[model samples]
Every structure is written in C-alpha cells, then in structure tokens.
Target: MSNIIGFNNAIFWTDDTEILYCEFSNTDPNAKLESTKAKLYIKAITTLCKGKAMPFVIDLTETCGTFTTSVAKFIVRNSELKKLRISESFIIGTTGVKLLITLYKKFYDPATPFRIFADQNLAQAYSLETKQKYHNSIKKVVEDYK
Candidate 1:
C-alpha cells in the first residue's frame, strides 16, 4: 500500500489489494465538507482511476464533516466520475453518517452500488473482493501530494 495523495483532512491511496481508499481525518470536529472539497475529492478519484473501474472505500469514521444535499447531488451528477467507478462503493462512518447515506441512496438512487459499514475491516474486505470479482488492479502511477 502506498499513499498517493493527501488533502487538508484526507488521505487518498490504493491499498496493496488494489482497492481505492479515501480516509478522512477525525481530529477536526468543526470542519465542514462542502462542495469545493467534494470537487477536489472527485478530481483525486479521477486521477487515480485513470478511466478504469475500481472499488472505492471511504473511511469517514470519527470525522465531523457533513455533506449537504447539494454536495451529494454534485457527486451523483458527475458523469465523468460515473464512468470510472465500479458498481459498488463502501463507506465507513458513524450512525449519523449511515443515516445520511441511507437518505442519499433513497433520494439519488445512484447507478452504482453503494453500501455503508460500521467496521473498516469489513469494508476493506468487501472492496478487495469486489476488485477481484471484476479483475481490477492497483493504479501504477502514484503521485505525491501537490
């Protein structure tokens, strides 16, 4: 596993098993994850995927940031992003975020498969399984934080 990218409160990378992972920091309780930060995340995912479909795992455990309805819509509306992802996405977070994810799924009905997990290990295992099922590989190009 290698750290390929880092933002203010998040780190993005492809693990040894080839699952794309985005882990948000838990220290900042007041941080708000707005549309701009969402865009940056999209950019990072696009760069990492490089037009290939891969399983994505988001670790939101202990993060205080909240996503607005508009931010969720922004992610769903990103056509380019839609093309580069596998059918499933796994998110790890608290109960509140899990509820939010439920609402998002109900409202958005995203084309991709999305699941929420309270356990990070379970999420990672699922992601790796998905990658293997689809025969995807870890991205070869790794970029340092800019």
Candidate 2:
C-alpha cells in the first residue's frame, strides 16, 4: 500500500521494505490536513505494522511544521495503539531549530528512538539497518523457543 497523497502527509510503503515514508508538502504552505486524515494515517500505519514495531522516515524537507502535531495528538489519544511502537523515526533536513525539537523528543520517548540527517539516503540506510537488526532479534527468539 503506497502513493497516497494529501491523506496523512505520508506517501509510500512497500511489502519488501520496513520503512514508512512521510512527506509534508513543500509546495503548499497552507496545506490543511484534517483531523480525520490524521487518524487514518495512524490507522494505516498500525495496519501496515501488523502487530510489530515499525520505523518511519519522514521527509520534512521544506514545510511549515504545523500538521505534524495533529498526527501526534491522535497517536496520543489512542490507548490501544500504544503498542504500535516506533522503532525509529528518521527526519530529513530538519536542522537548526527543528533539529532541537527532534532532539528533545528523542530523549522524551527513548523507547522510539530517532535520528536527524541532512541526507535522505543516510536516513533510509540507517533505518533499513535498524529494521534488519530488529527482525534478526525477533527471529532468534522464535528459533530458541522452537
């Protein structure tokens, strides 16, 4: 499931990869994302995760950072969805001021770690590596039990 625009500020996902890509529109400064869409985005992510922790690579390349809070609020409101732990969140090109905010969040929610990078490639690579390690750890546990 992928290529969904104006739905959640998120864009793509594929079966082969463990990355969820979110892009807040750089072109439209006043792009309004309704609350319903925010809920849907959370729903979509939870469904995609299928009862496992999932990491996201958010591309905040060029956009006012308003819509992000809406999504966060929805996640906070849902008690059952708390188990949808974000293994990692890589935000691209949010340096200087936004970087500080992200840093605070990193410490605030240590359970779901995150990294900031100027380059999307680096973020994606690290996300893939983290994802692999998670899968390997889970696999080892299952094998041991078997």
| Candidate maximizing TM-score | 1
Worst 10 residues of 2 by lDDT: 1-10
The TM-scores, one per candidate, come to 0.77, 0.68
- Judge candidate 2 against the unseen true structure and give its global Cα lDDT, from 0 to 1: 0.62
lDDT of 2 by residue, 35-139 (tens): 777777677666666676666776767654444565555655565456655555545554543664464465445456567776788878878877777789889
lDDT of the candidates, in the order given: 0.73, 0.62
**Collision count of model 1:** 1
| Position 68, candidate 1: lDDT | 75
Model 2 residue runs over 4 Å out of place are 1-9, 26-35, 50-52, 67-73, 76-86, 100-108
Give me the candidate number with maximum lDDT. 1
Steric clashes per prediction = 1, 0
